[model samples]
Target: MKAFTTLRTTAAPLIDGGKLMANVDTDMIIPKQFLKTTERVGLSEGLFHELKTLADGSPNPDFVLNKPAYKSAGVLIAGDNFGCGSSREHAPWALLDQGITCVIAPSFADIFYNNCGNNGILALTLPQEACDVLAGQAGGGNSVFEIDLERQLVIGPDGAEHHFDYDEGRKEKLLKGLDNIGLSLQQDSAISSFEAQRKLATPWLEKA
Candidate 1:
């Protein structure tokens, strides 16, 4: 898990009266045809690209994301275990490219959460009540929100705030944007020291 920290990003206003779309159905919001065109890059253009408008440049007014308030959103108050049902790192990549710095949810799939952190995106897990409050605020125009992971607080549109605590370890990885490989490399000095000590202590075991 990565370190968590307070982050502020523009939130995507969710419409349709708090409708919840979880698991694979979530990808329908994006689509696979666009997924194959690029690899973890250039995905932002494709993200919400189809759902946002028609080939004729007409807005799909019915789509939640296409709503006037959500068109330029950079964050999402998502359903539980979002990014579940698959291990596609592209999901977070697309979100990141679109300028979304974080996601607030009641829960998240383990791999997706990790992938988000690895790519410098924060994924905050809050209680359902807290999420509802955020979702409610999201329906407004350009609803900007902030999540302070260290303090476990969510700051809303009216400036009212709520708190939700998370594990200590997960917090650190996110703050630093360290993936597993990055974390391991951070231990390079310690690993080298250990190897030097082992060579002296077990000389007979070397190359034997």
Candidate 2:
């Protein structure tokens, strides 16, 4: 997991005009076909495959992610109920591969939100109006949004600050680049001590 403190980059909008696209499920983020691999690196090829591809198998030029200006976007201004279905961790993996480190939305599915934090991606919940404003700015082209996780602020292109709330424990883990495994390792001494005590108490079990 990468430490996430601050990110200053362009934002991509998953909005249509003033309305944000709702109920963007994990399958929509990365379709079933892309779930074959356990490795996270190459999943970007399947990120939003259905929406970004045409019937003829060509890239949809109209898609916000496919557009020239947003090709390198690092933040996503998404919709309400984003990441709404399935408990696939690959959704955030694909997003990370596509260079999006943070996602802003009005709401998110519980599992998906947890997965984002576990995988080092920031899933922010802001008011619907605030999301709409950021989406509008992102859709306007050549806009840069700065996300300061330490300060819990999202600075829009026009310099307006939008505050967001996050779980303190999750925030600390993200800031320190600690995943579940990493967090577990932090209790190494205690774990080792317990193992040693168990081994001494159950010598017959070890022999068996």
lDDT of 1 by residue, 113-148 (tens): 777777777777777777777777876656678788
Best by TM-score: 2
- On the 0 to 100 scale, the lDDT of residue 77 in model 1 is 75
Indicate the residue-level lDDT of 177 in model 2. Answer: 98
lDDT of each: 0.70, 0.93
lDDT of 2 at 128: 91
> Lowest summed lDDT over 10 consecutive residues: which window, candidate 1?
20-29
Q: Model 2 Cα displacement at 42 (Å)? A: 1.2
Off by over 4 Å in 1: 1-4, 24-26, 35-39, 48-50, 53-59, 64-72, 194-208
What TM-score does each of the candidates earn? 0.76, 0.96
| Lowest summed lDDT window (length 10), candidate 2 | 12-21
Number of backbone-clashing residue pairs for each candidate, in the order shown? 10, 0
Backbone clash pairs for candidate 2 read none
lDDT string, candidate 2, 132-151, tens digits: 88988885568889999999
Residue 78 CA error for candidate 2 (Å)? 1.1
